[model samples]
Target chain A: MPQLKAKSLEMRTPQVTKTAVLVIGGAEDKVHGREILRTFFGRAGASNGYITIIPSASREPAIIGGRYTRIFEEMGAKKVEILDIRERDQCESAETKASLEACSGVFLTGGDQLRLCGVLADTPAMEIIRQRVRAGQLTLAGTSAGAAVMGHHMIAGGGSGETPKRSLVDMATGLGFIPEVIVDQHFHNRNRMGRLISAIAAHPDRLGIGIDEDTCAMFERDGWLQAMGKGSVTIVDPTEVTHTNEPHVGASEPLTVHNLRLHILSHGDRFHLYQRTVLPAVHRISS
Target chain B: MPQLKAKSLEMRTPQVTKTAVLVIGGAEDKVHGREILRTFFGRAGASNGYITIIPSASREPAIIGGRYTRIFEEMGAKKVEILDIRERDQCESAETKASLEACSGVFLTGGDQLRLCGVLADTPAMEIIRQRVRAGQLTLAGTSAGAAVMGHHMIAGGGSGETPKRSLVDMATGLGFIPEVIVDQHFHNRNRMGRLISAIAAHPDRLGIGIDEDTCAMFERDGWLQAMGKGSVTIVDPTEVTHTNEPHVGASEPLTVHNLRLHILSHGDRFHLYQRTVLPAVHRISS
Candidate 1:
């Protein structure tokens, strides 16, 4: 019999995490010379990179696409493509997949998380994107609603509160790239902690990550999460929480949870998911 | 064939977590009306409670144990006892186990978490304690080192830093009441966040909870962990992190992680570990 204190429980951790993902909580300050965008470009390779922008999450894809095209191009990306697919069938087209596979990095602009997941989830285009990322050929970046959809358990919509309560947050399925977490955008300005907590309460054992405006939590394939931008990244973890009155209450009832673990991260904060710890990062050297 | 997004892995979650653990992170102001102690008493049945204090974690067990004995008695506990097991062999004595089994609550004092776990882990006394807790007969409370030993993954020793780095924190097996987390004491005042982060990084999937002076993160049988203190409880979660350079570093090499989630909880904050969220608690109604 194993000792009661033993912790190796045969966890089925992810096998290959060779891709990098940027989950940027939206309304990033572009007037500040787009610091976050520039960083993404650098990660994708500043000079010899092929960058693709997917505007599917936006209502006006062409406009959003056009705006990012200029930003990335100006950042010295060798080739910036506005990846487009007008219809559902376009997602299955070999031409689109091939084109996506050729990119060094992909960016999804802000709009609606549901809209983005609705268009791209389980599609041939998404398959190619995942393949490229896992194969170490591409870096995937998303902002705002695009960022929200990065996790497997996405927050479709929710109301906000200073203190956490149940039923305040709503949830929906997403692309599942970051399945163990639920990402929220425009965190502090909207005061989304309450809703984020509710979502985490519903999906027990998963993490709730809220990114502030102009802030980004970047994920590398090895499951290392780092914070960047002017604001902070708020993380809500209910894994060690000992009590929650959620199951006993009605839909509109307030939540009561005890022992929830949380973390607040800013620039130069590094976290390893596999090791389950935080490491402080030194300032990035400007290339 | 399994779909790519399948989250249903056969996770071997710990088989035992039936007891209520109140892991207090130390320096709790007992002089100021003993608010946390009062709350603890209320959980243990208040006026009709049988409370036991184990000061083995302290270098001066007698003094530390006496202090708590007086507090619990003053709180109107029906009976207060100082459990004595002088010899290591006494741990196997049926008399010791029986005496401990009678108490409604057990409070462990602060000093060295290692010594506490060393003396009690796998002992017959501990076996009985677990049995009683599993049967919903006892509440286990601990402070400082006592608090640290509440989790299965305990931080044995570590150096503090403002930024996280490799080899800063050491790990050891604990008593295992709260297995999913790594608890740290004297958080902010001592600048222990750096070490706490390193500890969390060393053990992935488990949460890192740093409790500050005069703070208590109360856990009940319902899996709720609540903060009742002047300082905050900092939570570090790397479960959603995608990458970290920890595996590649030496003792002093700065660590790099991406997308780490964090939360800072002060007074009135209640966290649910399973739900992975924090809920704010209103002031308690005196019993």
Candidate 2:
């Protein structure tokens, strides 16, 4: 019944001013990704905010590796660092922690959510990143695999459309920067409804955010999120569903969800999580 | 904050009023699947209702084809029939239409969502089913594949994990019984958040309902949905998110989502789509 107000694109100008988190969807930092970064941080007075790229994902070497650095440099980033968490040691290195601490904004490049989670689980870098985000000292932004780990529960993937067997797929602990939510990237482009729904069904209390291939849903410090770009994001909440998943069978069976609430947000829309409704603010983009 | 109220439970009474629709998830006749059916329909008076099972879904010969009929017979049903739509003509047969029209409720057995949609698309039987549901003359219930078709859009299967390039399995026309909503079966059991999110992201206006394998979420005449099962259902709505999902050069693109509302519903939970909030009257079923 309530409409979310939109903020001017101009408000995003110099996109780096007081941003507490910078979430980049997979494929961001390409053509539009850089432009998006400029819009957000360019006006912040800094040529570029500290950007840390995590190349631990599968597609990292192909996408965010070599030429990507030059592009970010050209985009006006003052400093760009890449954290290659391919090895266990790299994930725990002192340098990784220092880079995480020194940077104002950490960017996770596209790759594998499972890989990222596996490398960073219980690691010092993860701890530092989490600490910085909670302390409001640094902004955390991730694309693709990076984005998937923002939530406490990361979706590893699984079987066919008919069977939602948890063991069929894998799940790992996420960065937990944003508690109470599960993040999915390349949403519509990949037809990931089955997986996202499976994740929500597994954890009814957690919210599921599915980001489209060319879209980004960013959450601000005040706990409001806005959608920007071409596609939309899917938000799933199962707080009001009645179900009997067991049917008096196995003790540890998959959950069954009944009545649930869902909302879809496109560019410029704002949603308040705590209030659980759309805000009244209007959003606009400025050059 | 309102809670869902249960008008009646079939478990409490062996013989009761038959519903308009009976949706059975995949494997409904299978050992595990039967329990899911018994948990939901067993309590709803599966035997007493005019039941029709779509046997085209079963991988094996519909050996258990008459299982529902027998169950409902014991539950005090006047009659039970099985419809096999395997033949091309059977899908459009006059007998199908007459049987459907004559019945008080229709049951969709679980198998493959794609298969079910393919068999019923544009057929007279499909139209009759849709019309009956809209007219409230028939109670429509589906398990697994059957449930998938309940929504306007259906999720086919695809990729394993969080890869930006994973194919969007497939989406075809469903029964359209539930307008503006996409249904995913075996939701949390298989960690389907990725797929469900993708589906919701593709269609922002539609709400996604991911029912757990053994669980079922029922929508009453008043448009309120209640969950009943051992597991939970995941609802994803992306009305408020901000991000850029544009592709980066040769790299996998990134997606960003923000500020979406999510609610987790278990047994006894209620959600009013019109109000877009959780009702206080609904509460979780304690094991």
Candidate 3:
């Protein structure tokens, strides 16, 4: 019966629009960071929302999917399910497409950012997510490596705690969930500042956001970023920077820059992403 | 006799190597930024230096060339001549090619940055400058637009006084004298922080350098950038930046970033380009 319905919908384009992106830094304790999850659940319409957990970023997708399945069910999501597929080809199957088309929320588990982007970027599954997000039918959420892959320019790998220099970080294409910013997860715990700096300096026009190990930066449809969890979110603004030596120095040379403005926002801090303003926590999108 | 000899050397491969680039910010005032030019002259063997003035970046190349010719002569150069051609084709001329071959130093006058790169970026004259500089035979000095085109990425145009936003500035390829930095001139006087930031955000890996109206940032072959002039040189180092919104935001959206390390160096300040350290003013390369 479900197969017959899935085939019928093949002729119909999926109408899905996303409302927000819940990007969690790595090490988000599912227990302590449950409110962040609950916020997604609540925004997803409490017990009535249709949720699909994508654990493809993990090596053990089945195990991770089951874990989230129990968590969401326990959290009062009545129609919770998991998409248990490893191959990119499964996204094209009528069953998977049909299931995803009805989903009101999608959660991605953390593992390898590249793995996630490799499977989903430019794929049918990815297109549905984008279409749904643009149509405002779903809220997307991801953690750790999942979060890292949200931006178009993903930070693949780099060293930490060193001085900013040339070729210190590796960058690659990411799943275009959050298109304007470069997102780095597990930033504080991994001491990834040096690499993050390299990423931003390499493309200073993009906003760089480093989410701490336990934090989440929830980007709403209206372009507001609200912080959640115990850790901080570091914002690197190179817009007002006076100079950078990255383009002048040698490949292995140390880089010098002048006048880069910075901002560090903690949980409860609210930022207007479109207007680029720092609003008080309580002043944010309160229902 | 010197002209004939120069013409002969034109056919010979100009074995030129430059050891350093003396890039001056615009409105040099000859008096305030005179020490920078004096440093170049002194480093090029003072009165014994063979100098060629290329005023191709200027609209009035002949007048600009004549002015620098007299300045270099008055400054006690042994030989100072001009390559007064405006078209790119003239770079193939025997006289122009030979004159540049015998030059131990080249002084590029300021006018239009695009003009400078347009005429010199891939021209034979440019190749000679790079070859000579690489071989340590010539020291090139450029002011204003001449200075702006020293980097691999040039700040073509942008707005001022606004917070950093997407597409706020335009960038083009530069003269490639220095391959790692983005140079912006008349920084403080013209209030160019916004455009500089946009340029840096666009290419974060390339260090952004905004030279003040009277400042000079001398990039030595030893990987040290020494600051010179009345005003400060702003360096926007994105290596340590934690986040940037440039990749996530829309065309009209404002950009926000976090933790971009900045260094504002004034006269006498010396920074190690490879190590990215601020050295004591007195602790510099004492020739």
* Candidate 1 similarity to native, TM-score: 0.51
- TM-score of the second chain in candidate 1: 0.88
Model 1 CA RMSD to the hidden true structure, in angstroms: 16.5
Q: Would you list the C-alpha lDDT of every candidate in the order shown?
A: 0.74, 0.62, 0.75
Kindly report which residue stretches of model 1 are placed more than 4 angstroms away from their true locations once superposed.
A1-19, A285-287, B1-287
Best by TM-score: 2
Looking at model 2 chain A, report the run of 10 residues with the lowest lDDT sum.
A244-253
Residue A157 of model 2, lDDT score:
66
List, residue by residue over A1-287, the lDDT tens digit for candidate 2. Answer: 12222355455554446565545556664664555455445422246567676778765464655555666677777887777777767867778878887876666777778777877877788888888777766766677787888888887665444433344345667878887788877775565655676677667778878787656777778888776665556676666555524233242344344445565565666667677666422556432
- B180-243, model 1: which lDDT tens digit per residue? 8999887654556667766766676888888877778877677777777655576777777666
* Model 2 residue B276 CA deviation in Å: 12
What TM-score, to 2 decimals, does candidate 3 have? 0.51
Candidate 1 lDDT by residue in tens digits, A1-287: 47433434434442322347888989886666688887788777677778888898888999989988988887788999987655678888877787797888899899888888888889989988877777777888889988998778888987742234455667888887778889998875565665787788777678888887787888877888888876667677676666666666566644455556566666768667656566665775232
TM-score of chain B of each: 0.88, 0.79, 0.89
Q: Which CAPRI tier for candidate 1?
A: incorrect
